[model samples]
Target: TAGDTAGDTAGDTPEDTPEDSPVEDDISSNKKGRFHSLGVGELLVVKQKLIAYEEGEIAHIENVMKGEKRSRNHRTLHRTEEFTSFELEKEEETKRDLETTTRFELQKEIDSEVQESTKKEAGLTVTGKYGPTVEFTANAGIATEKSSSKSKNLSTSYSKEVVDRSVHRIQEKIKEKRTLLTIDEVEVINEHSFGNLESVAEHTNGIYRWVNKKYEAQLFDYGTREIFEVVIPEPAAFLRYLATNHPKEGTSIPKPQKPGYMRLYPILGTNEFEEVFIPLSPGLLTKETYLKWVEKYNIQDVLPPPSSFIVTSIAFAIDPVDTGVEDEGDGSLTPNWRTVNMKNTELVVPPGYVAKIGTLSLAIFPLHRFILRGLFGEIAIGTNKHAFHQGGGIGGSETFVLSNETGLVPVAFSLTTKQFFSGTLEVQCRRTEEHMEAWQISTFNAIMNRYEVLKEEYEESISGEELFGSVDIQGKNPLENKSIILNELKRQVITQMTRQTFDEFDAMREGVLPEGFPQQDVDEAWSEGQYVRFVEQAFEWENMQYLFYPYFWGKKKDWPVNSRLEDTDPLFKSFLQAGSCRINIPVRPGFEIPINIFLSTGEFPWDSGEGGIAVENEDGEEERDIFLSIAEELKAQQGAVYFKSDGTVFHANEDLESVLTGDLIEEVNDDGDVVLNDDGEPVLINGTNFLEDDINREINIGGKIYMIIAVNEEQQKITLDENISIQESVQYGIGAKAIGVPWVVTVPTSLVMLHDGNKLPEIPEAP
Candidate 1:
């Protein structure tokens, strides 16, 4: 009820909640802060455009052609070349999709079921005035209103109704339910009977698609050829989601369900974002569509009035104690809990995208619930191989930089879904790097080869095992499940691979090892018999290096390094081949592939504490200040422009919902104007709610030139008349072709034209 118009104070990070080690994070989400990440789809937009030097003046892609000569009767005719968009290989895309679906094989973590999920369960009361109710009836089919008189015959209650008295009681309770509840207040402590959530088709063949941006998602026909994968943000948000929205809840909270993208995206945020999207197919219920689907049959009444569904909140500080920047910890980074209010909840929408038939900005963006999904590791590719790394445990003894000859790292997705609310969690890591070897890339040629055959085979096997060659997801698929293909692929990759697996030395790569890993040799290599001797040697090197050049990571910038004594474990020496990770020849894109390696160790040695996770590189002061300022500016503009930036410059055009309320690229400036990205080169937008029109309405870009492009509306429709080969399509379909630059159509405010420049044709819009 109490919203800080100026926003609230930041909260402490979960890491700061301090206890023992970062192992398994014993901290509850309330204390833990959520982590944010930019998806590959988003990176695909500004990856190349990123400025090499943050402080250097850089040149932009020249827009104006050198001195034009347009005299007398000569007129320029700009050629309009068509892109000739083609359909991607559906079969291959399907396989990739299924593989991701099978990724969540792990079960639940702690056993805590949501006993009863009800907004009004606490029985809080507002005691407010009543609004007028309208007569309405429960229509059977498509919304073609029944006789007005017949509808009017219905009884009276809250907002609008034409139903029975029993319906009236339930409806009133629901209305009160919504008004009395806030997301934080409405807790689903346990799972309810999601009444037979599996598919009810004749053969039990079903698949599901969940689009989670907040705590809810819309279920869809997993059978759709064009749709498949889902994305999630980082760890903290996701963990919270799991703790709150898991199926453990009872009748109090109906299986947390929401509508389709169009109805939900605006509520999430204003951009296509990182989500813990599961390509799962929940089975069929009697309910047919998202808008009217009823999971709990006893419910009836006015639908809950619109409210913030998913909220995004960020808490941060400039300095951290871990950096030891200050002796008294004055510079320590901290989370400001005051910022943890409801108003801080963030929702987003994609850029250059809009509602299907409205002036609305991009819509149908994903919403995440309890859990936000994301990359726990980073992967890089080089010459014949690549390197991959996940955050390692805290400590110097087992610390390492494991290098692999073959870039094939096991790419597996595992989630421990608690089968029951209250019980001991028996997590038996089942999903292996089944398709670990298929991931390939060439930085030189800029080609990234991925082998999904293994993933595809596994899906096929899953489909067959589910009684009658199918399992029950939320709904039924028109075709058979592809789990069989996924299973078969796994069989081949696993039974055939020699080096693409956990190695004997894997436990010793560097950092903390799982409880039982070997540790004898490691102790000998870094034997610190006399702390005094080592300390003396360290001081000598630091003094010598300091005279020549500034120290880097303590040593001189170019100090010749010796292998860490800590790396005596042989795992660092072993190089595994990734050839079997795939079954096909490679296709490389631009840029030479850089080798990548992964050990059990984390990318960063530092682990999060009770306070929070380690503060990332960017403090985002310039970006943060500019963004806050823009939000203030938007109030004057009636929510026209929203901002998303990586503390760098260019911001992508995001949707209005996100624009209205999201982190600003620029915080409020002294004069209270939108901050410019240095007022120079083309701005690289991470995501935005601001448009070209907003430039004039908000701030001055100093008349900067930004290339505007139109979208290929027909891109979504791609079955063709031409003859095509499956292999060729598979190579390019789901891989790189889908990743690219925004369409260059019209400027943010510039208008397209009719021949006479008087009137233009009207077209239905979409997100």
Candidate 2:
């Protein structure tokens, strides 16, 4: 009774809840995290360490006879008292009880928590933690419950079961082969793909899910870089079967290796004639030679434009890029934290730009409420959070134990996407309501902190809001209400830097000097000294699109996007200090447009170890700067529309208008009018900037009025419908097989005869 000083609530202990009192109960109930069996080599190593630390030479150090010039000390006291230490008896006993009660409780977790103790391989030595401290390894020489044995056993069983099930299901599907599916049957397939990843028989229309599983979604390309559409009797059911079924050994279900994701769309009804928008797995819908196509195709701007990531915000903090902040210290609050302000951080990652956010960029954009209200679609407020809480203790103790007065400060805002220009987007914002108390475990002693509730409640009730809806086209800045996908209580540096500048820009324009930092005001005006040229060029540049800032980047195994980072190095350092941490990734890149941005980790190509951005292990740290470089080159398609349809017809800018119709009349360049030579053939413009490769060239195809068509690599012919061409009534289509995917060559004007009868057979065929 004396040791139990508490209000009488029983049946469990270590309460893991916000609503529950500090001692409400059952907290350690789910403490199990990781487990692994011991290897023979590892066992020997541990045993050696324990022996050395225990009864080895050091045990009788000073006791060695004082002969010659060797031993002078009286006693080199033995630090090892074996596994049972009388000093730590009380807590050790309690831990033992907890494990004996729960058989599955893993020693790995204990080892992780207290490394020095459990690491030694002293045969059957009690792990000081009490009950299961003496966890055995399969290679422990004698009878020991090795963690590897359990893992191997389970893995083998799972594999066998999967094989058996796949065979059984295939047989079933074949037996029940049916004909044209009805709409009901089709929708079922669609719905299944939405959920089950391996359900072969459960063909789904579209494989849509909280694939990010969390509320948010990130868009990614399928293998082919296109919005792939494989039409089956029941698109949904087929996809479902594909998803729910397991792949055979040695073979895996085709998946994006680096990104590990793909967005799928469903084809409905028995319509072989239907053409659905290919979802972006690329190859499915990735960018190609758009230079030749842009003016000719008449399509809007492209998604995932290239550019650098810069920070502009009000809640700015500036620290040496090297310094990192953490939980128990003043790193976060260091005066010189932000380099910019908050509002200024709101940015549009320009088309053709990839903003690589360093920690400083994030510090400027901390936990501000970013409200995204589209007049054309769903309106909501959210912040992608690098999860933090203003509470005590390590885990969620300080977080979840909150007073009934409030909810968590950081809550989730899930959203649905609409066609953004010609692309899709996943949008996350900064948090708005800091006062909102999340889950808490409050009692006579304390209350659950704000952030804890969010961690707990995220999995279940996040979908309460109607994440989707259409919008009314009205205002100019319709998405005005600021909803930050990442929210923080304090200011980041970038916010400060930019805010000062913006305010100065406003002041100078109005002929008024604000209070502090007059030079900052002047500098702000100076940074934009080139504003005219930038704006002019921006205006000159075509369609513009906006993307959210980087909130959190992580692996798929991480929880929902919870962790926050200000600068890359610092944020990473902070994570390193946290031991084994699991941050949220907003984890969705499919179904939504890239509302934002991944870290350089295990999944990325240039990783040294599992999830090692800073290279805690290994050498040869090759940075993955090349992939982004490639994507950039691909996005900036720089060439004229090469049309090799009838012959070598090249069109650029306005010349591409109504290109497929009749003789394409153009205002040619005076230097070389893209005209025919004296022999009535294409006069090759040697050394033109238009050609990236001498052998291969790109050409635009479709247009609003008339599109350009080219001929195949081998065949020097392009057949057009009688309506399109004035010469012959040929209904043949244009084919250019030589122009391998992406890079294409346009046909010359002579090959395609005009209705008005203008013909110049000058251009030669594409080699």
Candidate 3:
């Protein structure tokens, strides 16, 4: 019934229906038949047309289809299930076809619209409100309604956006190229103006005047403007001085043709002036012009040329009061016992004064007399009548020339004064020697060779010793005692050798020679007298063996020497070998005095002082007569005592009582509690003995006296008086007084003589 009604409606509106409508009379006359007859292509065309239809028309068609379906279902309600199924299938197929066609056509329309839009954009040219234009062209399409819409949207502010983007790009570039100022630079800029106003005005006026005379072209020309933009863009100022070419002549400005040399005269008016070169250019500033300007402005007074003067010699005028002498003492003669004091002397060079010696210019500074004395050592001002055979001279009047060999000037100025003194001072120059003599070289070589042999012997025989003949040395182990003795010996040997060699060299340089040329006889009487003195010292000591072992040694080997016994090699090739060879006679504590081998017929040059040991005589009675007999023999052979110019024999008294001293292993607190180590054991001084034997012994710690009440031998610790506290590593000495013998030390007086008889105060004897 619904199909019949649809047919009726279509027939009624056939004439009224639009001509372009898809459901026209042809399709309406046989709707189902026509739809079935149509091929895929025909059906697709119909579907496309239907899709283009308005929503109202599609809805109407859908409602009509639903009504028809419902009417058919009612009609088939009583029909067989098979027939119902066939009708339903047909209906579903038709619906599916329409739906597929609709979707395909809709997608096609959308694609068409997108393609049209792309074509419009491809050939688009947009002009912005601020006059910036952007133009684009397509290869094969014309612009459509979408293109016009896009243009309308962008045109309003496109030019402004372009300007903003360009500015942003320029800012980024400037940021990359600009130099950031430091805090100080920024502060300076904020605090001060760029240039002095007066100076800038004067400079500008000068430039203006210069430009007028030099250039012929107008200042505001196109070329000039371009230059100003390129070189001086910000302030619109011209830098005409930088121009190289003359506009009218088409030629570069000529450089100055003046001499490339000049001289700077000192403002203080000295004949000595330094010559300098003028690096000339095309600019207005030349050396001559600059000098002329300086002269006109009196700039020399403000910035004067550097000046220099030579100080040929410097001397200290010592006043009598500053000589360390009191009014109660004799002024003319220096007291034999008193030392000269120079603490109050003020020695300084005036400021702004430079001392020039040849090419060397030095700024002298003030130096304290104590520092000077410590370095140069009591620089005596005059000759001594008793020390030097020369006549007595003015005490502070004579100026002794220091020999360059002494190296006093360099040592004092470079090392001592330079380190201590800050202000200006004077310097003393020394005389330099040019050459050496043949005999001096030979003698020096001999002495050096002898020294080397002695050193070798010491190393071989003494330094490598396993035992020192059961003698107790400094309460140290055999090996430790050997090391100590060896070190002390080495130190003393080096000191004495240096002094002796220097003295010998000086004597040779000054043409002062010993009376006997090279061959000299040994003074047996003087040797005997020295031995007697050593014997007396040994008698007074508790352990005389200490003195004998260190000072007295049996001859181990004979050393090679020249005919004069002065050198290892012969002074003359044809000379016969001397009957007596040279040997180093031990003077104790590592010092040795050169002597002939003929000094003693016995194995040792000196007595061991062990002859007093008890020995039975032929009568079976113990006798002390052996030492007495030796003493009598020594006295019988005595003669006038002789002194060597190079060596002086002196007795050194050392206290061996505290030889067993050691450093505290741990800090002792004020509470006087026992210090503990990391493992919780009582701390003790290593390598020390503080047991039952050392209990109750008084000890000195850090200069404070304390009595040891308890001793821990296992830990090497001593319990001291509760009142005393000692720091870690503080040295402590035991009060055990051991027998100590005084030893003879043969010190060379050459170094002392260098000070020109200025003797240092005698050191008080140790208690």
Candidate 4:
């Protein structure tokens, strides 16, 4: 109704509002004298205008000061002109600052207006006969561009026929869900429920094979027949024989009468004088005095001497009747009655070992008896035949190295026996050697001997008949050869041995060595190449012991080491590169081993018979059906259009019904001139009216004919009513008559492949 008169403002002359005035002279002259010449009515009008402006209700402004009278003197006018000139300059600066401050405030009001207008809820009416007589209005929830003579409306309700058609379309879409070949081809059959389910063959057995390719590759790379071993002394040994005799030759020593003891001859070449004794007391002589004794007795002249001439024993008196014999009243005693009790006995020297008189203070059955107290204490020396190899190198495997025939000084001495079945044998014999060597020559000799054989073999292979053959090597000793090849071999051996030793020590320190190994021996022998190489080879073999010995019983077996006259490539070079010994074993190719053993005994591991547990269907047919149903529902939703509450007519992928009301679709700038793309095609703007290609055609709108104008594919907007004169241009919103194109929304099925009983399937051929 009010819109019928809205066009009048465009042509009507401006009129003065009450607010289009200035201030009164009395109030303005007090401070702001710029409005000092205002009348009473003008003052009220200015006050009202200022108040309305501040309240944000000011709608229109009229030419309030236009065609008004003015009066000013020449001096006041000159002063005003000067002040205006200065104020003009200052205003330029102030305008920049004011623009920044008011920009956000002005933008907020514009944004709110745009949002409110987009709702298109408010009604507009142009009550003038110059425009169209019929007033078409877009209902709500759909904003439209400003139009004078044309409008469009989307229907809020559909006819019963339209609803029935929509329902039929939805059902058809659901029926189309089963047409998908992917879903149709999927096996929906469940596993057999009652029969022998375990016997029902499976596609996959669920066994994961972890094939050790690295081990296989290293096992059969280089030399397949060569073997290497590092020689080391036995961990435990004893004096097998007393003289120049061998045990295997049938001259074996008689077994001891009692366990944990050994009897020795006190005199040389005399069996009757056999007794565990030494001539000198423990710690009786110092190094200087023992050397003097050596000069007096010529002890060093003999390779090994009898124990009685040098070592002294404690003479125990035995009664003549103690041997179960009557005294006969003759007062004579036989030697047989004084049998030497070697059990838990101690001597100044060890049997079968040469000693320089008092040089060594030995003990026997040291654990049970307190013999040679400090020298052979439980804490000092543990389970040993001699004190020489008691500590330091090779787990206390070091031998003795005594300079001259130095005697041992007695630091402490004791020998007292207890009654039968009363106490342990007590013999405290603490000897203080007046001498000790820095580096024993015997220890050096032992270490050198370890490499001597290897060195000789290496030299022979390099320069002997194996290599020289008919070539003249007569003038040169192969063992003494200093050829380049031998030197290189020596260098490589040294480098490899050093690296292997370092790795072993590191492993030992880090506790990465095999369980129960002695880290002490490894640490000590790490510097000696012979022992270091030995440990390295032993450790490497131990790691792959599973492959060598199928039924190993946790026993250390000697690796066969033979000197090779010819150079051969090792089968496994990778192990050698890793500073590990290559066992020179060849692996058979294409050997397939089962990942797991299935011990089938005509029975399932878990019972599935009738009195036992019931087995459900293994295949997941129900889950597949559920997923297919979900896909059908989502497909049905594709046809359901959502009318936006924000009044946005054009939505992405949305089909709209509208009538054409414009000439043709074309891109237009702010001046409304047709724009063109680079291809010379008319660019179509969105949310604008457009007509079909045939502009002369008339389109039916609500059974009324409207001239078709243009068609806009980009905006999907159709223009109509080209003949009808519109006072302004506006967008024809949703509901215009247009062709509806069918669309379907499909999604990928969220189906997962499962094993029997809906279990997560195990991956095969892992690692």
Candidate 5:
């Protein structure tokens, strides 16, 4: 009631109106003076005064009308008419103000409603599940259902039963089969070696849920390397399998045990194989040869091609010769020992010059094996000669030209491989107006925070392990040991210093720039930080094809591409932070593509433990599930399948084939004659006649008989009970053994989809 005290009707206009208001004179004066800024409290006071003035004016007019008679009535009518227009105008202004305030309040309510609706929709799209048990709703028509033309369809072409059957068939195809192949049998089966290769294929393909069902695929050896055809369900698993099972590149040589003997020793890095040649012969090395070997040992860059060999010789000529032979011969005209000069005076030979009375000169490259020709009548095989051994013996008068008999060695030989894990994922049940902005924001925050934690842990975990080999300074010949230890310590410091510089380079790559630092400055610092070209050399040596996440088909160019993970752009980081990428596949009416399937890896750098990486857990961590719990969430919001883009549908279970043992033969009593089916051909009862078909088939031929375990009529293959062993009869054991399996068995969701009760999103037709 107090709220309605302002005014009742238009005839009794509130005093707040401009007509007959107490503040009317004050307002008019302020308007004329042009100094009319009023505070909220002052304005409210003026409004009350105006209301009082209007009430007073209405009362005065009513009194005048009552006091006068007929004569005053005429004048009163004229006055009322004149004031009516003014009163109506003032009332209209009041109504306008009231309407504006109501609209403003209504707008606030609408905004809140829209926000709440958006949240609800997002939850449904991300967490909803749809299948036979759940009803398909209109909201499921997300971005995936839209098309440019009527021909583009993104709906299931077949019934859900077909997809389920397809999944079951795949499961059966990869079903485990027991095999008992003896060592001799394995050797005989050379053309189709089903031993190791088959095992590998089975392991690799078995990890995926969709394999060996409709499409026929196999793994075979073409030369030394194994080839997989449509078999890689997850690249991370494939890489790990190869690293563990595949042979290392180089061969291991037996170490010579003799006291004075020297041999080649391979130094293994995470991504490189380096052979260190022992017992370097300083005498055989010319000045040019000495510098080249020394520079490579220290991992320094090779100087540009010498204008003349003399230039290189003169550069290192300051160092004196350290190797020579001693003479210990009987009294004879010929000298028993001759010293080989490796000094500046030992004129360097021209390129490709094989002297008649001298040794052959050949260049040795990095990561390649080479043979060394010893002047002592033995060949030393190595990459390069770094040290020398001096001895006295009967020396030959003439030098013989050495032959180039060095065998080549490949890179990464004898080095361990890096390991990682991967899997696939898909999103389902999104509505048409759905936006991924929220999901993207959440993902970026999660990943960036996780990365920060890991990075901090790595930096804090550094214990400064020395780069050089450890030497005990307290052992015998302590002084010599101390000197060696000191030199090692110095090298370690230098290495750590270089690594720190590289760390800065990494910071720059990651967009962590110094204040006021220019792009040119970063480039210059990067070049200097190479420090003899050392920056993740191990990773370079490994030569991984897809070092960073190889975003699937449509997702590749979604963001700016960076050659290395360390330099990925902001948009790419956002995608990674989101922990998912969208992929598009073709769709048809009978076939449906499930949005739950995706290809991904559970790899995040810095999470990999020190020295090398291991799977996040003994049983590799489930990747997509870690980001969002689709399994449980979908259960609550049943009957919705979400999709991000358009794609082709997959038809399920189009092939079906099975085989079992033939009916057993049994004696029958029918007038002392054998019973058979129609056509007068032995009416077999619960028995099969082998003679029915032209081709003869027998079970456990030439051996004890047992029941049939399983059969696949598509391939005419059969599995007999393990108790029975058939003899080596080609015709009898036909289609008995199971083959075609690679690596270990574990199904990836990306390659072969699991169709349980999942339904496809509905597609809207074009207008």
Candidate 6:
């Protein structure tokens, strides 16, 4: 009944109201309306009428309140006046009661309509605009008339089992795809032969590793003189399975030597060779008599022979023309030879007697005398000790001896021929004792013979028109000319001897010699004896050939035979050149641009060892030289970059010093110490003139070498002729030549190519 009354009141229009009504007239005149003094129940009825108006009629009421006409003839107006506090309270209470009753009735009607709609839609499907039609099945009738009860657990279990099997199959498929997409291995082949330029694609296998999200491979060739090509597959997560583990730093554990691989030793220093002595027997003389004999002989410093030794000797032969001339030379061509005199010095001469042109008798005897002091301080007896010493002791000791008994000592014999002879001259090297092996004697003989042949050829070359035409030696006498040739011959012989000695040493160490050879005994003795110490010494003096055999052997090919005296020494260079190796990387798509990294082998001149520039000033404080500081800064900024094939355009990130014209802060290591060489001298990774001499040079980086065809020192950029991919975590040793100074620096490769400022190329999804 309230709903009907409210609806009726809401439906009433201004036309429904009588025009003669006193209440309407009064409201129109005042422009505001006040409710008549009615009871709370009447007000409640009025409030319901107004609240029950439809949304469209509410706008009409609002217009009437604003005194706006809804039609041309009929006008509507509505207004409200504040009521007394007590009257307003009473009116609010009545209005709330009416609203609550009206809401309760409306809710009841909505529930009734909803029940009717549900009954009509039961067991039917309803479709929506956005989704598939869903059907609802009613089970009310079945529940009321159920006759039998059963479990549906079997059906549910079957569905669950099917789902699990489906999920497992999907996972297996994903794993299989991943495995197939992974790049396991990459192979690198030389594009051109180093020895034979026409021959191409010499296969040289190298090891590779994926570290720190980058692929790295070892280089076999020193790339300084070789071109290489690397082939790799697309990058994928599964490729990591084929990566080799990176070597840990400062690891004391020695790697297991592969079969047939020669064992290497560290370079020796001067101190290790200071007081060299050789033991009479191996393994510390277990015999009590021998020990007592050693003590009785007062042998205070007896130790096993060094793992290896370098023995040097010079042989000079004069021409009859120079030697036969009266007052010009001695009549006897045989020079006076002095032998060390010892009490029990018995010479065992092998049965071989032959005399030939340039053939001289070589007596291999110990030169140094070791005295055995008696109880009364009188020298009881003295034994001769040969000048067979370790690497660093060569030419440092007063003794100049060669004993055939010392098989491990490599004999570097030099022969100088002073005569200008046309025919071949056979030089015989016969030892006084059978202590020398046949092979050793033959080796020495072969060296002399080679020297003789070379000397003859050289003499013939210069003695003819070439010598007479030359302004420098045009009027020189035959003796003077022979002297010049002899000097050259001596140098060639020494070089040949040194090379032959190293070869023999390597052969012995590798155990590649004939079986049952005495050299085997020498090898074993050296290996079992102080071989570890020897290796350590070799490593310490890695840059010096005289101290480190392996370093010398590795760099023997690069040795400057015709270089200046200062250039022949490693200490003067300050950087060791390492052999080149190959590296392979699986790079993301769109980032396949080849990047050539140029490295310099420069170091701070002040931080150099023996022959290096001074680092400290008169005040005893380390002086910071501007040039050296620049050198140090350049070393820190050494990094890899992406370069175009044109060798002009290159890109590098901010981490690298893309611009060279800036002041740099000095860098100190974590220990607060500057980088130093083995001799504790301050050293720069890149030498002092790297920036100045960085243009147009081939640099070995991550086993690949790139020639910097063009360089922009201001922008710190370089270009290459060929493209190279940039790989993170690879080492770059850049060799650069400055103004009369050559050096090398090891740069760590860590860079990414940017298409724009701080924007990287889009990496495609792994296949």
- Taking all chains together, each candidate's TM-score versus the true structure is 0.14, 0.16, 0.13, 0.13, 0.12, 0.15
lDDT of each: 0.21, 0.22, 0.26, 0.25, 0.24, 0.26
lDDT of 3 by residue, 1-767 (tens): 10111111123212223436432211111111000101111000000001111111011111122112122211111111111111111111111111111111111111222223433434444444544655544354455444222211211211111100000011111111223232211111112112324422422110000000111111110000000000001110011212211121222223212222355654356555544546432233332343543343223232322123323334322222222322435433321121222221222222333222211122222232321121122332111111111112211122334222211121112222211111122334322221112222333333333433444344334322412324322222434433433333332322222211111111112222665354321232223344334333222111111111210121112112222122111111111122211112122111111111101111122332332234356899965423334553353233111111111111111232222233334546689887888899887644454556555444555555445566656645455545443233444455431122223322111011112122232445899
Which segments of candidate 4 are over 4 A away from where they belong?
1-313, 318-426, 430-440, 465-594, 597-767
lDDT of 1 by residue, 379-484 (tens): 1111112222222211011121222212111121111211101111111111112221111101101110011222223333433343242332331121222232
Candidate ranking (lDDT, best to worst)? 3, 6, 4, 5, 2, 1
Which parts of model 3 are misplaced by more than 4 Å?
1-526, 529-537, 540-686, 703-705, 737-767
Location of the lowest summed lDDT over 10 successive residues in candidate 3:
221-230
- Off by more than 4 A, model 1: 1-475, 478-608, 615-767
Candidate 2 vs candidate 4: the lDDT winner is 4
Candidate 2 residue-wise lDDT, 24-71, digit = tens:
212111111111111111000000001111111111111112221232
Taking all chains together, the TM-score of candidate 2 against the true structure is 0.16
Q: RMSD per prediction, one decimal?
A: 49.2, 48.7, 68.6, 70.3, 61.4, 65.2
Error of 5 at 311 (Å): 90
- Please provide the root mean square deviation of candidate 1 (C-alpha atoms, Å): 49.2
Name the lDDT of candidate 1: 0.21
Measured by TM-score, the strongest candidate is 2
Report the lDDT of model 6 for residue 580.
Answer: 20
Q: Candidate 5's residue-wise lDDT over 593-693, tens digit each?
A: 11101001111221111212122444777222122134523421231212111111111122311123333344567688677666767654423322222
Residue 217 error, candidate 5, Å: 6.6
